[model samples]
Target: MENIQHRNINVNGINMHVAEIGEGPVVLFVHGFPELWYTWRHQMLFIASKGYRAIAPDLRGFGDTEAPPSPTSYTAFHIVGDLVCLLDSLGLDKVYLVGHDWGAIISWYLCLFRPDRIKALVNLSVVYNPRNPSVKPVDYMRHVYGDDFYICRFQEIGWEEEFAKVDTKKLLASFYFKRIPNPPLLSKDFAKMFNPPPYTIPSWYTQEDLDYCASKYRSTGFKGPFNYYRCFDLNWELCAAWTGSKIMVPVKFVVGDIDATYNFPTIKEYINRGGFKESVPYLEEVVVMEGVGHFINQEKPIEINNHIYDFITKF
Candidate 1:
């Protein structure tokens, strides 16, 4: 991995740390949960080598960045505001935006709220959840499907504490490499994240990666990232301001077919109706890799970087 320089800047008065490489068209990579700027190490080098300025920043509470005290600070608007201020801090009028997981959620909201600032939008893993004027994510999911959905449970109390208490070794093991146990604990174990046996996170995560994440959570804790869930109602409420809008900029989305998210019966409809397909006026592509999972960037950097390069270069 290429070692890059870290730059400190104030985004909306919060101290934010960003790693930047190369110098050309700006391509800002935003990482997801349980990850940091280091997660984009491969992409940064690949984009930089192509003469583009590649930047990856730890979202407010995720890494070396400042973790605001209140869970409310992690709201969609606030997260997007961080990016806006980050762009201003870098003196960038607009830049190509690429994000994964939580970052994709924020990127979608940013595109909805501030399309003028993104030259192109590329998402990994997380797809845009369409706004349902009358229902929340949990209620909507329950209404469409049964209540066994894991994310619905993630919204309940003590979830963060459970996640926080997980063995860092196990968590890292799951992400770094694919070593899923046979008969994998799927729907039966998400709520039992604190349980034993196959319930524990995989061993693919290295100690170094685990240490990096654990250190950050030790200071910031999971409350901020968890708050992203708490704001579902708020997100829907805020989104009411732009009910019928679509992401009009050039866009691309990629995900792993094995991602737990695709298991949802509504996932296909969500992708089509939630603005990834022809719904987005300028959407360029949507790719679903057969064997990858939620951690696309880390699991398959070459594919991620190639798609990104191909997308941005086309524009």
Candidate 2:
């Protein structure tokens, strides 16, 4: 495995810190919320050794990337633009794209907006939810279940400030703790993992990982990333215009079966039952890892790397 070389490139009026390794057909990794380029370390090394140039960049609001002042700038449009600029900066006309969590969402939007630029796409842990042309996340929550959902509350003002004030180490530990294995039917321990307030800690995450994540947050704070939630309406408005657009490129999706994000009844039962063909016309495969969780890459790096290598080799 080759060591990753860190580089910065001026792209889209921002200086982006990019980590690249190996040299062949390009593979770009986009990290999700609460993660950075470091999340792809195992994959980067493995893919590089396999004769593919593996690259990861700190997304706009996370890690070493600049944290702009305006919350409005964190929208998907900006994120997509940053990525497009990154590809241009690297002189890649097309490349394989792999993303997890929020990164998955951005990759979905990218495939919709610019299919020509993506050779293939592999998504982990996040599914594409087509935009409701008439309503946003807040409106969807209101109409279905009132405003009791913690995610809805996260959209409110001062929410970031409150979350930012907490101990960063605890926050990272709690975030990682929720993904551990549970009984056949999510047990009390698993249920407690998703509790809102304190975000109860799990024992699996190492102190070193927690400390590293906390240090990054200490420097960047959470405002820029938190602002992503605040731009639901604008993102929806932009997405509405692309409703009928399909991801025409080759695509694959992988997720952890026990991931809390898909704990909703319909999600588990009907996820593979595809009725929305127009949204993802080229989806090639879907993989569900049994005991993993939201941090799919970290929790199951070998499986993730194998899937990525298998997919990218076809290109």
Candidate 3:
């Protein structure tokens, strides 16, 4: 960790924080929900040691980056725009792109909106979900998964307040250690999920790590992060021009076999069959590690790092 260098740079009309190390061909790492650039700590160090410049930035609403108050500011275009300006600020034109969960979603948009800026991509967890065109994302999620589904429940106006009420460290622990292999259901009585006694930290996560994330949330609150979900529909509406677009960039995807996202109803079929390939025309590889859960990179750091290095080296 001491080898990593941290800095804040101006990008897309806000101050952005980034962690970087080593020096060679650049590899940009983007993190997911409930995570900051710190989540990629292991991979950054490992990849940097392997002679590649590894850069991880806290997306607009996460970590030390300035979080715009309006949910409308968290759109795909806004997030991708921040990254484009970030690369330009750093004097980089194209780099290897890697992202996980929401980061993966945004990477898909980045490749779609600016493939010229990406040499190759290694995306984890979430697959590229093609727009339906007929229904907005939130409405589609509600119709398919019902109101209790976590994403649907997150759409409510004051949900972040409810999240704030819980103890920050404990709330983060619950999210990090969760192992349910099905779609998450968060009822109106969602507080109960955090109320279970005797919570244990997973082997992959430390108390210090939880505290680090908690301290950031304590200062910023969860509103900025939650706004990412809130902008789903608006993102859908704003991306109409990209309706039938294919990701075109060279790509590799990885997911944990037991990860809740991989188990989503038809996700397996979508990934294994022609659908994923149809959209990601340049996909190069797919790996499903057994016994792993949602936080694949942190849960299985060495293997994840190797996967990333192997793919990026080819380019």
Candidate 4:
């Protein structure tokens, strides 16, 4: 990790922090919520060793990147714009893309809005959710998961304060290690959810890792990250033109069987019953890793690296 290089560059009207290593074909790694570019440390080094330049940025509102104040600024357009401009600033015309969680979500939009810029993609944890022309995203989520669903709860202000009241390290540990396959619910007493007794740090994650994440969140607060959830409806609205659009880039997707996202109602049916392929017309492979959770890359680094290397090397 010490050999990896970090720097900041101006992109999309904000100074963005980026981590890079090696010098060859570019593989851009986008991380999900509550995660930083550091999340890609293992894969970065592995891919770099294999002759691919690995680039991971702390997306807007996370890590060392500039956090714009408005919730509207966190939409897919804004996030994708940041990336597109980042690539432009770096003098790359096209690159292999890899993302997990919200990063996966943004990678979908990148392919949708600017397929010309992507050579291929490997998205983790989340799949392509086609836009519903008639309903907003948050509305559909509320209808399916109700008000206590984490995304819905994040829409309201003050979650940052609530999260702050709890021990930051423990809170992050609970979020990173919990193995619940069901979608998370954030009730009125959401803070209590992090109070579970005696959490054993998973072998894949260390106390130092937990401390590093907590330190960043404690300094930046959670509002910027929560703002990503706040833009669900807005993204739905702004993306109306691309409704039912199929992602045309060659793609590979991987997920953990135990991940809550994989267990979302009807998601398995969608992925396995041709719905996922229909939306991602060029999807080449799907890998489901047993016993892994949402953090597939971190939990199964070598396997995930092999999956990425195998696919990206094809083009």
Ranked by TM-score from best down, the candidates are: 4, 3, 2, 1
Which residue ranges in model 2 land beyond 4 Å of their true spot? Answer: 142-148, 180-205, 276-278
Of 2 and 4, the candidate ranking higher by TM-score:
4
lDDT of 3 at 284: 86
Clashing pairs in 4: none
Backbone clash total, candidate 2: 0
> Model 1's lDDT to the true fold?
0.75
lDDT of 2 by residue, 246-270 (tens): 6788888898878866664356555
Clashing pairs in 3: none
TM-scores, all models, native as reference: 0.86, 0.88, 0.98, 0.98
Candidate 1 C-alpha lDDT tens digits along 123-175: 98777765767777768765665544445645665666666666654554454
Worst 10 residues of 3 by lDDT: 189-198
Superposition error at 220 for model 1 (Å) = 3.2
Per residue, candidate 4 scores C-alpha lDDT tens digits across 1-315 of 888999999999999999999999999999998799988988999999999999999999998999998888899989999999999999999999999999999999999999999999999999999998988888888999999999989999888788888887877777788788989887788776556677888888788888888898888889889999999998888888898789999999999999999999999999999999999999999999999999899999999999999999999
Q: Is candidate 2 or candidate 4 better by lDDT?
A: 4
What lDDT would each prediction earn against the true structure? 0.75, 0.77, 0.92, 0.92
Tell me the TM-score of model 3.
0.98
Name the regions of candidate 3 deviating beyond 4 angstroms. Answer: none
Candidate 3 overall lDDT versus native: 0.92
